[model samples]
Target chain A: MEQNLQTNEEIEMQLWEYIDGSCPINDMQRISILIERNTLWKQKYDELSALHTSFSTNVELEQPSMRFTANVMDAVAATHVAPATKKYINKSIIRGIAAVFFVMLTAIFGYALFSVHPTTGTTSMLPKLDTSKFNLSHVINSETIMIIVAINIVIGLVFLDSILRRKKEQQAVKP
Target chain B: MELDDTAVIQMVLQGQQAAYATLVTRYQQYVFTLVMRYVNNREQAEELAQDVFVKAYRYLADFKGNSKFSTWLYTIVNSTCLSHLRKRKDETILLEEEKMVSISDSNQAERPSDKMEQRTQKQMLENALKHLPESEAQALTLFYQGEQSVEEIGVIMGMTTSNVKVKLFRARQKMKDILQSRFSRELNL
Candidate 1:
């Protein structure tokens, strides 16, 4: 009795696969023979066949309103559809980052120039530090320093402007 | 000649945003129907479907094209509907375990003619689907209406193909069982 019940469920499952066209050709042929000869198999096959046909062909699908495509397109446009891609790289953010890096580099270079003192008489087995060819005045002049500072400030301001604009844009998108 | 989904995607990515209308039209019925199975309301389902398309557009670049576009689309549909369902689970839909199939009879063996049987089964199947768990109902719809293969369903539902097959089998079996029980009960009444 238990085996009969299992066989019914299993037969139904195989018929489901066979009707779905998921069964291999060999299994299809085998199941076809069983349906042709066996009354139990034929009865189950008839019932499942109808259900499968109805599911695939006769089942009524829900249709959207006429404005579905238009509404979806409008929503797509209104939303910020651009993904986080390199193509949308912000120039202002790049400039800001460059300014910050330049400021750090200039500070380090200036500090190194000051740190190198004139080690004159304290010479050992190690070669004495040669400060003769160094042109400190030319490299660290007031005008050049001021120019670098000005460029840094301009880039920093542009970066700041972009960030503020982005914040406003984010706020606008929130609602 | 009509452009395929990949070509349409490339066009959209290249700044011709209007090209997305093609994909939207192609998949609107599918997306709308799948979401309707979850929300079960026309207005909310339409709204959810619209949001899904927009979300898909936003992340269109993430689609690698290695898989069928429909399979990828279903993944998005599943997530969108699941999240929305989570919010309304308490009020609207029952939990999976709570959805059960109760068969009242197993001995009635009278069968109808082929044509009439098909029609009756169609009606019975539609009614029986309402009594099933959402996963099974969806599996049936995806297999029948969406014409999705069990393998593709596995990818979408994050299950193995065998597991998906079991779900499909159980779903069909339960629907048939529900109809039989209904038939037996009506005869008794």
Candidate 2:
């Protein structure tokens, strides 16, 4: 009885594939023979066939209001026009700038290393550093503080702008 | 001959913005139906469908013509609907409510007996469709109404062709099961 039930389920699945027109041709022929010879198979096939026909005929497509296209067009008109030219960020330009910066940094380091002639008497090529002389008060002047504050404010504004733009893009992408 | 979507896109890019209206009108019904599957609210679905078109227009310049225009538009529709579904995670519309509303609407219209029967059958099928899992419903709808082949449905749904076939098969079986039980209950009553 268990074996028969398993076989029936397999046959039912195959019959569905056949109904959907997704079965292989050989399998389709096999199911056709089964349907023709077996009353149970024939009954199931008939019922499924009727249901499939109803699905094809009865499921109606929902229509939007008459103003749907017009509303979409108006929304498009209010937005920025898509550029005809490529608007994507050019990676090549960015890579080129990065390459130049790297090369310049390497060249500067190479120069500093080559200029450090240990053999040239007692004058060290490295700059003398005195931590005690470097006072935080000197660096914390009004003008310098203002400059640092201005830079932070500019960076913060740019960061906030990018976050807002990304949120808008996300919203636009959602239905 | 009418211009193809590619040609229409080119025209739109070349400063003929009105050319886009043709595409919009051509696809509005299809977009609305697809979005309705997710939202289940006609007004919200219509709004989402319009949003799809507006986004499509805004991003038209990015289209590279690698795929069919309809495929590309359907991709946008799918993602948009999925994101909206994610946002309204707890707010799915009940299938029973949809059935009641549809039946009430049909009652308001003076239909012939045959037409009423047809409407009831259609409603039953729709309710059956709603009972399936979302992926199954989406797969069946895309296969039947979107007129997409299994391969195309796979591309749109981000699944393999075989997976799409399985989903379609399972969806149909589940719909059949639902209809059988529902009809049997009605008969008993």
Number of the top-ranking candidate, with lDDT as the measure? 1
lDDT of 1 by residue, B16-126 (tens): 899999999999898887887787779999999999999999988877775778878988998899899989878887765555712222223334332333454445555
TM-score of each: 0.66, 0.66
Compute the lDDT of residue B157 as modeled in candidate 2: 79
Residues A23-122 of candidate 2: C-alpha lDDT, one tens digit per residue: 7899999899999999999988887787777777778877899888789888988875566345567778889999999999999877777777678533
lDDT of each residue in A1-175, candidate 1, tens digit only: 9999999999998998888888999999999999999999999999888666656775556799999999999888876556645557888899999999999999977766665555744423334666787869977999999999999999999999867755643343231
| Deviation from native of the Cα of residue B89 in model 1, angstroms | 2.6
Superposed model 1: Cα runs more than 4 Å off: A84-175, B101-124, B183-189
Tell me the tens digit of each residue's lDDT in model 2 across B1-36: 788899999898887888999999888877888887
User: Where is the poorest 10-residue window by lDDT in model 2 chain B?
Assistant: B180-189
TM-score of chain B of each: 0.82, 0.79
**Per-model DockQ:** 0.20, 0.23
Residue-level error in angstroms, candidate 2, position B16 = 1.6
lDDT against the true structure, each candidate: 0.78, 0.76
Question: DockQ: which candidate is best?
Answer: 2
